[model samples]
Target: MKSKIFCDNTAALMAAVREGAEGATIEIAAGVFELEATLELKARMTLKGAGIGKTILTHVAGWKPSTKSLPDPEMRLDGLDTDAYLIRLKRDTAGITISDMTLLGPQLHGAIFAWFPTSLHLHHLRIKETLWSGLRTFGMQKAKIHDCEFVDAGGRWDSGQPGVKGGITGGGIFAIWMSDCEIYDNRFVRTRTGPAQEFYGIKVRQGTRCRVHHNTIETNFSMEFPFENDEDNEIDHNVCHGTISIPKYAGGVVPKSGRTFHIHHNWMKDSYALEFVRNGVEIDHNLFDFDVKQDHGNLISAFGNVAAKGPASFHNNLVSNPGRGVIWINEVFNNLEIRNNHIVTRTTTTPRTEGLFGFNPGSDFTSIAIKDNLVECQGLARPLLRAPESYAAIVENNKLTNVSDAKKLTNAKANRPVGLENPLAFRCGAHEEFTVSGWKVRPTKK
Candidate 1:
């Protein structure tokens, strides 16, 4: 197949592909091409642009259908009948690359909707302002999304309520049923923020051997892994400024049982950091930095099957300036190991309220271990670790300062310096060379 180049007409670009220009390099020159229909790729090819923000592709105006009879259908961003996606990679297509382009979906439903691709690579692309989602893929074997930016992706849905559970769905990148995929060195910024169904920076569900690392997700709401039985997934070295939740019912299914997930070496600051409501998860060597705000607070919150029989470990983490508490061990499951963590409270003279750790009601700590932790507070007067009488298992070597006596707690130590520095100074985002574990990271150019 011969390579073709299109400068202005997007219809000619699609026409070239339809006329058996498969397995070829289709270069789009530096200009704004308004798409009239969804560009479909059926064969293995490369869709390259001049550069990011240099070659622009956008939707045609009046693309959204109008319904005058259905009582203000203009306000409905969801369920709009549009057969338009900026790029559609059809099923069973292998070895496709879409790189170095700015896809602006103003009236389109989604930017890229790909399914069942054998191999897909999205590199150095800026996909923004998408109405539904930036990039959505399903049933892929090998996929690599690196050095890309997904900004302001999802749109708002009106469920009649204004501030409460507004029906907002879709955002950033959502990959499901993927195997051996690497989503790294990407930036998801300013995504839609509302209810849980509204927006997400990056969401991977029911994936196997997927590694999502070294990505910067700064948005109203961060990441989610909802469904269960996702085996051997690693989320590491990412910096998230918002909430990273594993909700109780993601995709309407309880992920009570699954393979273990290793979450480590990440920086979660500002909002609620890690909210895990499932088992088979390990969180370690992460920095949870929260500068006490009344609206947005809390560090680590875990609530799930209190009777599950597996062990989950939270170790070697640094928690600083906690607004609500350091850890909210809501419901006690079997065998939770909290060890080697350093918790330091902010210096405040406002009467020293709020417990360092809050144990919610109906929590049974029969087989939980809290050991070798260092807690330093400035004005907290409450008990450092607040829990029930049954929560008395292996609490030892915890050095405390400016906290009340460890009467109910056992094996306590004292007089330890709060020598932990700010962990946010370390860079957790993407780098030029991908030197992490799992997959070998490489840039697009080289």
Candidate 2:
């Protein structure tokens, strides 16, 4: 075997990358490399560092950025643009692997960014303190990002930057128009700087056939893939301190396989867990545990002007201390199956008087089923199903404790639930999720 090419300094590393052959392995030694401009990567290259935190890459002191504005691939944003990045790959580049490095920044832009990379692999990276996202890519295919630590990796758009209409821009990983990807074993965290209005763990727009599992996200809005025709996306085995949001009305229709997203087996520590009005989703076998004293909202809510297009199901889950209620819908919802879940509410300062499930007017009761759920309100006497007379027929086989008027739990005042009107504004910065009308915008280019 040939001897490995090692670069001990920034000059040697830049020279090796500029002169190295394709498919060459370049090892970076343990030191801080402050770059003046973005490090452009080539195809079929491997850039490995000594180890996490040992090989640090950052910007040079008082580095000035180039004013570049690229066109948005999704056509929703005004323009795709950025000022700085530690490393960047040209479009359509393939087989690029980067591992075991730290990208430190309180700088202008992201750590690693690209567009239309056919294949990209990243692992064991410590990315922190960037103004923009830790990683941002567009139209990537067959990518794998795992075992990365993102600490305060995004804060660029949370502040009021001029010309940015939407306040929520950056995140830990923001990939758009991606397919066939696996993002697992990652940890996203924010420091004690304060709460942020818009900073997500992972936001995948127009994602297909993606699996995001085995990750721990501590941000308020953990993961979001909203209304971009996302199909065959599986989100499971994760721990979220806040909400796991997949905005309602995904792609406006279900895929031919009859599902849009399958979410299961997550440990949710907050009461405001799910946000959905999407068609063809099944959530099961998870734990939604919340402390009653914490700032809380409904367990599941769908806020929109329209109903779902296809069927959905929620079953076999365990919920504790459901703060406001469970399965609250602001608009008409049909063909939803809720069964085999155990939900219990403890003693709280503000008791929930309504039942766990609430629907808006014009819901089809014949198609919705609520059965086999064991609901126990610790001391408060609440109804099992609190809705109009139409909801009286669908309640079946549920074991209730401390329930008032279990047989006829109908209420005329249950038509329009409060706080459900602004469904798009539930979380801190949810306006950005629906700002572009993403369901109607489909990119013709790959």
Q: Write down the lDDT of every candidate, Cα atoms only.
A: 0.67, 0.73
**Mind giving the per-residue lDDT tens digits that candidate 2 earns over 311-412?**
888887777888778878787778888877777777666765667788866777878877767677887777666666546446666777777766574322
Measured by TM-score, the strongest candidate is 2
lDDT of 1 by residue, 45-84 (tens): 8888889999888877956523212111222324443355
The residue ranges of model 1 lying beyond 4 angstroms of the native Cα positions read 1-8, 65-82, 155-166, 191-198, 248-259, 303-307, 347-352, 359-364, 412-426, 432-446
What number of clashing residue pairs does each candidate have, in the order they appear? 2, 2
Could you tell me which 10 consecutive residues in candidate 1 have the lowest summed lDDT?
Answer: 65-74
Clashes of 2: 2
Off by over 4 Å in 2: 1-4, 64-78, 156-166, 195-198, 390-393, 409-446
